[model samples]
Target: MKLQAVLFDLDGVIMDTAEFHYIAWKRLAEELGIAIDREFNENLKGISRMESLDTILRHGGKADDYSAEEKRDMAERKNSHYVSLLDRLKPADVYPGIRELLLALREAGIPAVVASASKNAPQILRALELSELFRFVVPPDSVPRGKPAPDLFLRGAEEVGAAPEFCIGIEDAQSGITAIKAAGMTAVGIGSEAMLKAVGADVVLPDTRRLSLEFLRGLLSA
Candidate 1:
């Protein structure tokens, strides 16, 4: 089948907001009396905000210590910190070649969708001034489950009226790759070839800077 739509992940794949996420996560960890590093942050990628907090809390052996309300409060605090950091974002914050790729997909008559786990996806899109570029932007609240479960990407395809086999998903995290595969779409990984391959991505690119319709089509045909 011909490719009908492309689904993108928001943070590490579309923008360099990983730093902001890490900063907020680290701040929350410190306040919660836990330790976190960049390596630990890698585990948080492509997951929900509450899930990220839970992961760090579990790492600190404190996951079961907090009540549900307390956990929600912590997540909210982290989000407030993250929202404050978005002030520094601009169109320039978009990854190199991302806008061009979106434009190319547009010129080629392909619909693009963003399937990020971030609940603040809409705000992030507006901050980057790329809100109008997508056919559908899947909000985190729209689905009960996030990446690694296939719900988000599947919903993206559904919202765009594309069949799973006719959709392509682009992501920079292991969980995202797993989700794409589970959704039965073409998985395009934006990171190291070895890591992406290990996670079962159909095609892996070093970065979006190398993305082209020809390369993608060839991969699909292969």
Candidate 2:
């Protein structure tokens, strides 16, 4: 099979913005009298901002306590906090080997794009100074649904003019792996091997440092 495009998850795969997300969500949850820890934050991964807030509410048994407007306000508050944290990001903050891998893909004539669940993907990419490396970043709003629905990854392939079967999607969340599989693409997970395997990832590397063009080509050849 020929490699056509590479779809990347921005938060964990390209950079470590997960901590900023966690901080923002935790602050929001605290203000709402809903206790959220790092363990609870895992459930928010690969989901939309509203979905993450809803998960927090449900966790605290307050899912039905807020009106739609109230929830929107809370989500906005979280996003504001998250965006503020993003200002601290630098080009060197990008995950090790990710820039090299992206450059290798570019040199090899392969297209790469972000299929992140984060609506602030463009801002994050620009902060890392890696905006020009990708073909394009798929806006979260462009998709009808988020991870586990396959809309985002499918859209990434569409944007790059690649067939789903010819694309490779790298992610760090279980929901993302499921979405890639649903899109009929090869799922390369960049986190816990067991956790990703449990979610049907085609391959799971320990982290982005293990990701490379040669490693990806092996998957394509398989």
Q: Write the per-residue lDDT of candidate 1 for residues 95-204, one digit (tens) a residue.
A: 98888888888889888999998888888889888887887898888887888999999998998788999888999999999999999999999988898899999878
State the lDDT of candidate 2 residue by residue for 1-222, as single tens digits.
889999999888998988999999999888989898899889988899999888899999999998999999999999999999999999999999999999999998899999988889888888899988999789889888898999999998998899999999999999999999999999999989999999999999887887899889889898
TM-score of each: 0.97, 0.98
Q: State the C-alpha lDDT per candidate.
A: 0.89, 0.92
| lDDT over C-alpha atoms for residue 58 of model 1 | 94
Which stretch of 10 consecutive residues in model 1 shows the poorest summed lDDT? 212-221
Candidate 2, residue 135: the lDDT equals: 96
Deviation of model 1 at 216, angstroms:
1.9
